[model samples]
Target: MDTDTPAVSAADSRVRRPPTADERTTLVAFLGWHRETLRVKCAGLTAAQLADRVLSPSGLSLLGLVRHAAETERFWFRTVMAGEPFEGLYAGDGAFDVARADERTVDEAWAAWRREVEFGERFVDEARDLDVAGDEPGEGPVSLRWVLMHLLEEYARHNGHADLLRERLDGVVGL
Candidate 1:
């Protein structure tokens, strides 16, 4: 992130568009809105700012949130939904701990997040129906609908964290 980075306008950040009639469409729209909210919260900040743990005694940072969100996407969409063999993004290490305030780290984290998002979108698009099933280890089969709802919940929770992180970093507020 950079101060000069193009700002995501308020209009673009907000979920003003009404969701379609389809359940899948509605769920996807909500999830996309949450994802964009996180990105907007992170926009125009430097790597150091992104990695700063504004809340003392807590290692939570915007950078860490983004990385964790990416991993969450991969775990649900690729590993569970697509039934693909998955490895942890940070080599089994906690995502927050690996969020360094360096150009390379920032670049890699964003790139990985974007890539996982793309894959998730593609998977959703190709699914025949919300009932489409994916096998989860130990949990047995889970429906696409369930996964979408879970993703929405996951993003929404983390986006709230992102909101606070942004406010602490720059006094910026609102989605």
Candidate 2:
């Protein structure tokens, strides 16, 4: 069994952002940082370790976070921005359900996350500008800037949770 099928290297070797850049560049850089942070946190773990409820009573495994992030990516990019049909990868909170998680499940979650992330990048790149609008829940015509900020916050918040989860899993902390 692949005990550590890491998707990224240590946080120290992160993707460096330009010292100064435009709003879009900054937003994308920050989002990329947070995404890499998650990958760093989840590194060096077996399938069982990735799926372990180290915090028990809460099924927020590293694998689960990847799954949910994929879901979020699809929601914001495909459903809201492109008016594409939307469906959750897992039923209800099944994204957080890792009781049956194994190597295959871990691979699937990672692949889905990577796909959504790539699609989101492509969508953003093709947009006319940050001012490009989309229909947000209960809000009419929210701009791409708003979506970027929302996703930034979402990933930041989840990354914090990931910090805790990783620490509990093996006392590995800081990122």
Candidate 3:
């Protein structure tokens, strides 16, 4: 294990179960659950372990997934939902290209991911309703509801990838 890698345990995080009532509450809870699932999937991995592309012929790695998730959160929440001026974290290239096993890279990716998540939570909380819309570059207006749903789908898909990556890395399973 790299000395710079922080020890993490799956049990340290809690994912909220989807609520039975209220559209907004249920959506938020589900999103939170998916987010936590990603975190849990990534728990207890060293920086080098995270960067390993266990599945050959594909560039997918746990660290890359983290970076990709961060970029996804930033794109939907800050750029699409809030209409904030956006710039890609990895600049000209995609998130996966910037993924590295080094401590600095890992730290930056996690910080960016957490920051985007925090901003997303605040943006969703302050929205007047799920009907609140933002303009997409080519798709015209998109509602908060659509964004939330899209985010849920995005996280769920990536969590599946993370699951596979985690299993390949350490034989850990179930999240």
Q: Candidate 2's error at 121, in angstroms? A: 0.2
TM-score of 2: 0.91
lDDT by residue for model 3 (1-175), tens = 3332334766746655665769999999999988877777877777788888888878899888888888889988888988888888876546776345777778878888888899999999999999999987877899999999999999889889998998988998886
Encode model 1's per-residue lDDT on 1-175: one tens digit a residue: 4332326343455565464567877888888888877778887777888899998888999889888988988988999998899888976647887446786778788888888999999999999999999888878899999989988898888888888888898898875
Between the candidate structures 1 and 3, which one is better when assessed by lDDT?
3
- Model 1 residue pairs with clashes: none
Runs in model 3 lying further than 4 Å from the true structure: 1-7
Off by over 4 Å in 2: 1-13
Clashing pairs in 3: none
The 10-residue segment of model 1 with minimum total lDDT is 1-10
Against the true structure, candidate 3 reaches a TM-score of 0.92
Estimated TM-score for each candidate: 0.89, 0.91, 0.92
lDDT of each: 0.82, 0.82, 0.82
